[model samples]
Target: MDDELVLDPYPSKIPSLMDPSTSIGFLQPQEINLADQCFPRPQCDFFNPFRTMDGSCNNLQYPTWGQANTASTRIIQANYSDGYAQPRKSVSGHELPSARKIRTAILQDVDKSSPKINLFVMQYSQIVTHDTEFTILKELGSNGPLKCCNKDGSTPEIIPKECLQIKISDDNNSHSKHRCLSVPRALDTSDRGCNIKPVRQMNGVSSFIDASILYGSDHETSRSIRTFKNGKLRRQLGPNGKSYLPNVKKATELCNVTYDSTVCYVTGDPRVNIQPDMAVVTILLMRLHNYLCDELRSLNPKWDDERIYQEARRLLIAMHQHITYNELVPVILGRDFARENYLLPLTKGFDDSYDQYLNPTTTTSFTAAAFRSLHSSIRGFIELVNEARKITSKIRLSDFFFKPDIIQKQDNYDSFTRGLLTQKAQEVDQYFTEEISELAVRIPDRHQHIDLISVDLERGRDYGEPSYNKFRQLCGLSEAKTFDNLIDQMDKKDIDALSKIYEHVDDVDYYVAGLLEKSKPGSMLGHTFQCVVGEMFFRLKYGDRFYYEFGHQIGSFKLGQLNEIRKTTLGLIVCITSDIYSVQRNMFEIPSSRNPLVPCNSIPKLNLSAWKEE
Candidate 1:
């Protein structure tokens, strides 16, 4: 059967080419055709004072620059092994080391927790990542993951072209007896209309830091979630009487739901139920949106639903950007990096840094390699703590994959919220817990498991990302000419491990080498990753015309409104939205003598009076 002809829910721009082994030829200049959807054709609404749901018209000049469903922007050109759209190969014309083997060799099982920061840092990082980039995967006819391995643990006689199954060995303890990990290639704009362009992956979500995670990315999705009457998003009351995200019936297909009453949630982002931490954060933002609407409506009783909703949405997006730059970016990239690059939000005045010429689209390096290095910080289990900061119960993180039944239980929402704010995340390093390294997501009815460490290694190659040394040079660091010269950026032990597995210094994958390097001062990432991530954030701010801090843009907030947004923080957002009574002043960091837990009322909130209209 031609699986490409199958009805895929999220269809790709080009149909799958039938032959897997044939090298695709480039199209002649005259033969190249660009489909209408391939390029942005936004009908920008100037003077709207609001961003469109699909991210259109954000850049008035380049209507689709940061729009959803557009091709990702690349800092460095893709280096496909076939000079077109194939996965990258090793420098010696041989296959790279097996992903599972790389995992076992470099990443050890360790439970090292960060001393200064809490798991909220890791959890919120996921929220920011989901907001900025979401690479869509090729799907089977049933809209499910492609199954490449047969029941007998053998490759299919006629494998589908979409299947890039990770080859595994039986001796691998994590898999037990499974021999393959099914991994479908991410969908891209390759071979579409014979465009003669390099295969560039598509981002399912908008590249802008708009609240697409709360409201959907497209108009249809955004409308589906709204009530249309009171400017509130649809929500179902939890067993505890507090509002929660609306439920979907496709729990059996999308989630590992073990209960009958509770099903998977319907959120702006489809990956919401991927983990409980992500679920809690998504719910918080959803609640924040509705909360802002209620406050805005109370202040402006004559305002209609559309006016109230847009005003609330505008505030929510501003708060989201504020927390991301002020709290999240500083922690991950370091405060000094944030200041030096003008990545921080201004406290009082407008930032005159909007650049229409710059493309704010998520880069291949940031989405595929540099940003993914933070996976090392994820802990093995999701801890539930009481208001008193006492550990009541712990759930193995893997067991709850796509299963959010536990979160809907009595008091579990607040408990999990507190846990994230109080518990320390795994220290950012090369090590990973067994939960992620061994028992990651498993293929249905198959004994195989997806090792995320392995998946990250393979994803970089699949994206045709340049090797570590090249990226090092791109970041202005010394590129190693030989394996021995890697000592400057990498520890002696890390260089020794790379020398054993890789054929040459140039063959080291970007994600692997970046994670292995020592952390720069006061930053969670090493030099190359810091530089790449630093540059990525710089673009996300200046390249964005509707940045909350900017003054002269079509959607720019008033000076008073912008200043109130500056007062927003992760602590205040959590305090007002959820049932948590008190939290640390800086929820991103562990509660210390300087940054101690304070009553919710003590935390400064956006005085909605700034938004009151005459």
Candidate 2:
């Protein structure tokens, strides 16, 4: 074959059929098939119905393919800290302020004011995040034992000092053994340290939100949870006749931690048992899938189980993409940024902007730092309400952690679903509720609790994310040379608090600095975070070959189906899945005079007839 011709520029229009070829024996084209040549239809056989399981679109072999440092030599030069350590006390040779101390200082509860955003906004943010990125840390084996502080009266072992959190006991002793291991980074050909690997689904990680959060990423896990019936997932009817995830056998066997209750339901995602809200969202999506399956079966009666399952899965994934782009993303990133970044999908037809060369893998920084910024928006308690918007009861978020059985109780799911709509999300600020700040997961009858803020900061370092200044420069912002530079982005008090822990501005952790910065207008994130997150979603939307909105792809939704997908929203989804009677038109925003709650029947529903085949 002749050497491939590389053209820097080409003619705007193809030569007409009447025009003769410049080269002998060569034919002149009348039109150019740019879509086929540039982005050929993907082979559907390899496509996982649950997710775009193959890494052909994304850089799976090398997940850190598009990072600032991709060269093997550059990995050696990268800075990898054991943990985010505090500045030293010069005289005493002791650490001045600890990570926990800094957390308590800047992340303390200032006011319990709920923001204008609704609870679904917070839930969707977390659900979308869980779908894309999940970084697993290396557990301490027999070799490394966690070190306990002398004050706690527990056996002391050797561990990284920076990983310890000073936990004060009821006896007035400070026990400092909260072990946090560094996340193992991907190794280069020579086995040198590189970017951290996402343990969750990485292939087309951004496409259709990976569905890892809905169906567990592994095939065996997904198969175990699925019923394989009429293309519908298995679900059990609760005492109230509402659908709930089927309970697993010996649930204790699947516990992530010792304190977790063993009696949890088996869902596509194992994290369903991690938190009540997570379970709620997972069950909601599962129900949506079943509902779509039923509709598709009705429309295509002759379709077999496999055909119905694939189409229903396709529609379900499209619905998720639609909600994320149209409903959830606009509220979180603000409408302006959503439009500016091309995150919004067209109302009808296909988008031909899918770039085969673009990698859709989730970034380590995004998973470890930027996306986790929403922790500040989490309320300490989960409220249950009635149609009258009356609060029936409030459940502490920490208390329900890893104990999803509470949602399985009689009428509890309905109450929680109602609460999701009526309740307001915590304000988006540097301050976090005490439940999340100090007592993230409290084991029943156990005195110890995990602090999420500490985990977030330490996780950033473990993932080998660069300092705040480095990321700012990476995101095209000026690197802060002095503490004063951050003043514009962060409050004076937060700046003072950060300075006390970090010796220099360059040493600040990305999670701490980014969360403390002032949020962009109509957004819950700061400029740097918004830039990183916005860019991530932009690539996720534009780079995937099988993106639901794009027409003419091998397995993409039909134009009419895509239009129907655009009609889908979180409000309609909740109404279809749950027993809720009324909801706000824009479920992502708090119910108000402008967006008031209406009867569930009043909400617009997606027309399944659009998916009908003649």
Cα RMSD (angstroms) for every candidate in the order listed: 9.3, 11.2
Can you give the lDDT of residue 467 in candidate 2?
Answer: 69
In the range 307-421, model 1's lDDT, one tens digit per residue, is 8888888889888988899989988877766676677777679888788766778877889899998889998988899988889999999888877778888889999999898
Model 2: colliding residue pairs: 216-268
lDDT of 2 by residue, 501-591 (tens): 7777777777788888777666667766876677568756765555787766666676777777888888888889888888888887778
What TM-score does each of the candidates earn? 0.91, 0.79
After superposition, the stretches of candidate 2 with alpha carbons farther than 4 Å from their true spots are 1-78, 81-97, 140-156, 160-208, 255-263, 442-447
Candidate 1, residue 63: Cα displacement in angstroms equals 0.9
Best candidate, lDDT: 1
lDDT of each: 0.78, 0.62
lDDT of candidate 2 at residue 114, scale 0 to 100: 59
Best of the candidates, TM-score: 1
